[model samples]
Target chain A: MIKPLTGNYAAAWGARLARVGVVSAYPITPQTTIVEKLAEFIERGEMDARIIRVESEHSALSAAWGAALGGVRAFTATASHGLLYMHEMLWWAAGSRIPLVMAVVTRTIGPPWNIWTDHSDIMGQRDTGWLIMMSEHNQEVLDSIIQMFKISEDPKVFLPGIVGLDGFILSHTTEPVDIPDQDVVDRFLPERRQPYILKPGDPLIMGNIPSDLRDNVKMRWDIHRSQERAKGVIRDVDREWAKLTGRSYGGLVERYRCDNAKYHIIGMGAWVGDMKEAVDILRDMGYGIGLVKVRYVRPFPGEEIAETLASSKGVIVFDRSVSPGSAGPLYLDVLSHAYIHGVRVPIQNVLAGIAGIDVGYDDIIGGVTMFINALEEGRWPLPSKIQWYFGGGEWWP
Target chain B: MSTERYLPLARPVVGVSGKTGTWRIERPVINYSKCIKCGLCWLYCPDNVIEIVEGSAEYVKIDYDYCKGCGICSNVCPTKAISMVPEG
Candidate 1:
């Protein structure tokens, strides 16, 4: 059934279709409506599940972790400071290897107190061992959440995952989403088969302290290995989902019109849509330009990124958050991947949309034009390390 | 099929099969004459080593094999019939 729904409601529909057993959440910005819809479903008898009202984001994730550990499918959602509050439990969930899913509405972290969209909150949690994937639109938001459960619960990749969409941009925006039937979803995602579960008669000891340093090191390494293995599972799940629903988001990263392009713009999340428009405008003006949308950021997709950008003369990386003193986080990863694969294309880091400043196609096109001019004039690398685009006026500290 | 990297879901052995009594520095001796059938010591024992044997001379017996000599039973006893004596 096709319905005009906000990204939040689409996420709720995704969880409902997946038949999540327990949902533990605390209300926050764009994420509140996602759980609110879940509550409505439960109250209206549309869904059968336990909704845990938590005191804080910490308790919210902790309760979800407990439920997943107790051998049931679990979910939760949060944004910005709420995600920060649940930081410690994020590591616990991943380290414990619980196959749970969380929807994070990407928001700006505040001292100035803003609830706008940015990648800082989710980017800050890049190292927490959770498989992170960003969505470009409302439909992707729903589809990614469903795919996340299947990927996370795979025995080869028994790890938690985070599905992130830009705050307000996708979360509050209304778009037509095709909600699949529950029976079709059931056929796609069967009952979770975990290697271990907490049961009454069969008591189990989990999360015990390791007695040896070697054992501790090995456990952490195992998580890393599992994440590497998850790439295959992600692709497989996407293939199966496409076979069912006729939609597939080209595995790790989706390359748009890159076959004959000389310059490429790389980005993730909602801004990718804006970048695509910019690419089209530049292409019509006889500039061989294209866009590469990064779907999954955690496993990094280094090989796919390197392969896609190999033919481009130069690449502009648009980052929504800054690493401060270093280049943008996404830029850094792209550079490292390119270097590893021996693809030495001149890459420029354009920091845009920090603190949720409105970044449109015009600003994106202007950034690409600057990169193109530099590449043509033999002035590649353009003096300064990072370029700030669309920040009102440049006030350097 | 337990890997050294992750915890196996199987239950850890419940009772200590190894003789934990070797770690006991002191043992509790019960005075049955003053002992009431309240069973407070059995409930208070941390290691669950104290068992109630109805027909025995003293209604309660401590299995020293698993007792750690914590003296929790002596501390909780209301009648003052149990004492922690140094192990020779």
Candidate 2:
């Protein structure tokens, strides 16, 4: 059934449908409403889950980690400073191979302290070993959360997952989201069974003894192999979800009209929606423009991305997170992929909408113009090119 | 009731093999020539892993089976009387 809902509400509903047994979280902007809705569900007796009130994001994640280790389907939500506070446990959760899911409401990390949307918060944890998936809209956010549980909990890929949505852009914005029936969701996602749960009669140790070099290498190798297994799990989960819900999503990377297009713009999160609008506008005006929205950021589907951009005459990468002294994180990944496969497509980088500033129609248009101009001149622009002000300095190259 | 600190279970399978491997305690070898009744190893051993016979401090030896190899006694010996070596 379709309902008008914000991304936070959609996530709450998705968690409900998945039958998450433990919900541990600390309130943080953009993601606060998500836990509020879950609390309401518990109070109304609509969902049966343990709601834990924690002192900080650290405890929230830790509690979730413990509960998941106890063989329960666990979840948590955080944003900006809160996510960073739980930073170390992110690796702990992933390294322990706990199949827990988290909703990271992407907000700008700050010194001035902003509560608005940006990719910096989630971007800071790019190497934490979690299966990171970005959502473009409320429906995708909702759907991906439920789907992430399936993919991450697969025996072959028992890795933790994080579903990231822009802080205010998608989290607070109201949109039409199809809330699947509980029975249908149940049919899709069955009860979780973790082989490591502690029992009275049967006991075992969890997350202990990283003894020596061989053990460390073997454990990390197991994580890497499990992560590689997630790629196929992602595709299979999306396929099964579509069979159940009649809605299909692009598994790892989504393509928008790249059949015969010369230029392909690549990005992720809510900004992909803005880029789509830009692509639609430019396509109508007779510009052979296309787009590729990367959904899974970690275990980054590098080969698939390289193959898609191989035929494009020009490419443009938009990153909302800056990597200080290096290229923007997303652009750097794309550029590195292109370089690895020897894809000789000229590319332009646009670093815009940082620190909770929203990426709107204007930024998309400007990015398109930069791509078009660069393509016409046959020159891939260097760093610090085609910048947007967004409360700072705007310099055109 | 006063609660006792948590002690690791002593399953027989884990006997001396597990004890030496599981705990950080290393066995201290006392060179008879190097020993001069310093008695520092027994005084500083946190787990009481060292046994010193006679108040004269003339004889000292480590109980390898019980000692958690913390290496504390090696640092406290005034005359470099004790040295630690890994369990066999």
Candidate 3:
């Protein structure tokens, strides 16, 4: 049935439909409603899952890890600092190769004390070996959570995953979501499988100290291999979901209007929606621009990105977060891939929407026009470094 | 069906640290003549080096090769039948 739901509610519905066995998470802004709705589900007996009341984000994920280790599908939700607090357990959960899913509502990491949306928090966790999925809207948020369980619990790719939605933008905003029937979802998702289950008589130690150092190194390699394998699994699962639900999200990165364009605008999370609109307007104004909205950032769509952007004259990468002193994370990934693919065309970074400054289609149109205009003039469209685009609507040097 | 895991998983086993008795500078001596087979030493051995035999007069046995001479067993034995002695 189609219903109006916030991004947080959509996430809660996704976990509910997937029949998550445990919900253990501390409440953080923008992420609080997700667990709040889940608590209501458990209270009303609409969902048959246990909610673990924990004092901190660390305990929340540790509890979920134990539940998943004990052979139950577990889930949790957090935003910003809550995600940062779960850092150690994040490594522990993925390193143990236990399958669980988390909903990360992207929020600003604060010293200035802002509760707005940004990708800095989730992007900071890019190297921790967990499968990361960033969604542009509420529907994808709900849909990917279900798919995340399938992908993570697959024996071929048994790593923990986080599905991210931009805080307040998607998390608090209402959107129409098709909540799939439990029967259809049941057919799509199977019973959560673990490499091994902890039992009373048969004891097993997970993440135990290895006897050989090379074995520890091998396990790290296993995580990397599984991640590579997950790219294929993610594609296959997206195809299956599209087949079943008629809602294809283009797997790793959704290619929008890239078929006959001179430039492609690449981004992830909520701003991708605006980027699409800007692409249309820019095309109307006669600048050949398209959109490549990233879905899965971990098993990054390198091949897909290379194939789409190689023939283009130039590429502009939009990063909601930067690595502080270095280039934007998404720009770095796209640049490396483009170089490897031998696409000499300039790929530039435009750091917009840091700490949730409102960026609309007009801002995207103005910024991208400046890029294409620069290209037409045979001048460097962007400097080697990025300046935060707060020009009110202008793309900067 | 090979039931190996995808990660470095360790199962419960004896001598996970590799017969740590090799690191011992002393040995635990169990005196069967003290005549108490109370099994406290077997129960308290940190390394599980002490064992109990139901059918033999040597009701309690110690695997000195892996004992590590921690004296945990000797300290816990109520009958004081096991003592830690300096090794050559």
Candidate 2 docks with a DockQ of 0.04
TM-score of decoy 1: 0.89
Which of the predicted structures, 2 or 3, would earn the higher TM-score when compared with the native?
A: 3
Q: Candidate 3: where are CA atoms >4 Å away?
A: A381-385, A391-397, B1-6, B19-88
Model 2 misplacement above 4 A = A382-393, B1-88
Question: After best superposition, candidate 3 residue A336: deviation in angstroms?
Answer: 0.8
lDDT at position B34, candidate 2 = 76
Candidate 2 per-residue lDDT over residues A193-277, each given as its tens digit? 4435655655555555444556666667777777777888898888999999987877898889888988888889998888999
**Number of colliding residue pairs in each model:** 0, 4, 0
In the range B1-88, model 1's lDDT, one tens digit per residue, is 3444453223476453588898899999998898887899999887878899987778889898788899998888899999999999
For candidate 2 chain A, the 10 contiguous residues with the lowest summed lDDT are: A388-397
TM-score of each: 0.89, 0.82, 0.88
Model 2 local distance difference test score:
0.82
| Model-by-model DockQ, in order | 0.37, 0.04, 0.51
